[model samples]
Target: MESHPPAGGHSVRTRSQHQRRKRIVQAAAALASRGGVEAMQMRTVAERAGVALGTLYRYFPSKMDLVVAVVGEEIDLLESSIERRPPGASTPASRAVDVLMRATRGLMREPELADALIRSLIMAEVQTPFGDRMTGLLLRVSAEGLTLEQASEEQRDLAGSLASVWVQELLEMLRGRRTYDQIQRRIETAAARLLAGI
Candidate 1:
């Protein structure tokens, strides 16, 4: 008996496959930004990406998969933006609030993307990958800018939970449920009052 090759004649992705996946993801995001998540259908996304419909499905098992990946990419971009900021503040509260304010303004600039992400989160359609990755990025970035003497395991967990709340509240503020001034004032006032009372 002789060994046989796979059906596609290649078992691993080539550079072309990597480029194809990138294009597909970009197309999906463009569609998502223009018409919301509904525009991210396999057929439409493939058409936009210049790939076959089967290829799109091959890359993304579900709609949630693609959207979650998009969310992850956006979060990475935001993380990089923070990484570029010069680290200065010494106090934990000061550093944390500075990072939060910077992130809030970034989200405000992308209302459509923020809306889509929030819908995915609230509907429970997206899964845990984004939350975990972005939370770690945020903690590392904030820790670098703050004077916290190494975040303990418990403190790290608390920071992750607080980050989730901050993101959700920021989305709500973007949706006009709360004004920007209100959110800004509330965040600073809470932090300041807590520090003062402590």
Candidate 2:
């Protein structure tokens, strides 16, 4: 079974199917929030979502795919929040750091969920739908933070680099290898260094 829907020429889900899928993702997220990825069992998610276990599998062929969907939901919320209240720093780099740190802090508040999502993201194969959607969202948010009217090749590259720095620091934080302060400082230093000239 396909882990994700086909990129194009896919059959559309009915409204009820869409709602059920939403509930499944929400259930998985709630479980992860409470106890991280380990808690998000297929049976439990199906129960909480009020869908059959078979139905759950139909939507998400593997646990990793389900976790990736949960992460996508979280990032969507972050993107909406950023849109409502754009970062307020003066320099492009500072604004980028502000956006990245805001995301970092948000995840820190829900450490278990953060761990689950970030770990799944790291484990996902490159160019998969799950990976592409999440990466695009992160880059778009980074671009907004930079206040780019139009993203030049250089600006897009910087955004990708900033996202890489953010993800690496987040992994370190989740591993207990870096404190919040350390992560912040590292991200700040990285942004400054990477965006030095531009």
Query: Which candidate leads the pack in lDDT?
Result: 2
Per-residue lDDT for 1-198 in model 2, tens only? 545552111254677767778788889999999999889899999999999888787788788888877877777787788889877676666776877788888999999999999988789763345433433544454445333335567765766677787888899999999998998898888888776655
- Would you give me the overall lDDT of model 2? 0.75
The lDDT for every candidate, in the order shown, is: 0.64, 0.75
Q: What C-alpha lDDT, on a 0 to 100 scale, does residue 194 get in candidate 1?
A: 36
The candidate that achieves the highest TM-score relative to the unseen native structure: 2
Off by over 4 Å in 1: 1-12, 122-127, 141-150, 189-198
> Tens-digit lDDT track for model 1 on 1-198?
373322121243577877787887788788878767776677899898999877776777667667766776777787787678743576544555676677777767767766776567556554445556545554565455322346566655655665666666777785689777777766665544333311
By how many angstroms RMSD does model 2 differ from the true structure? 3.7
Which 10-residue span in candidate 2 carries the lowest summed lDDT? 3-12
Clash count per candidate: 0, 0
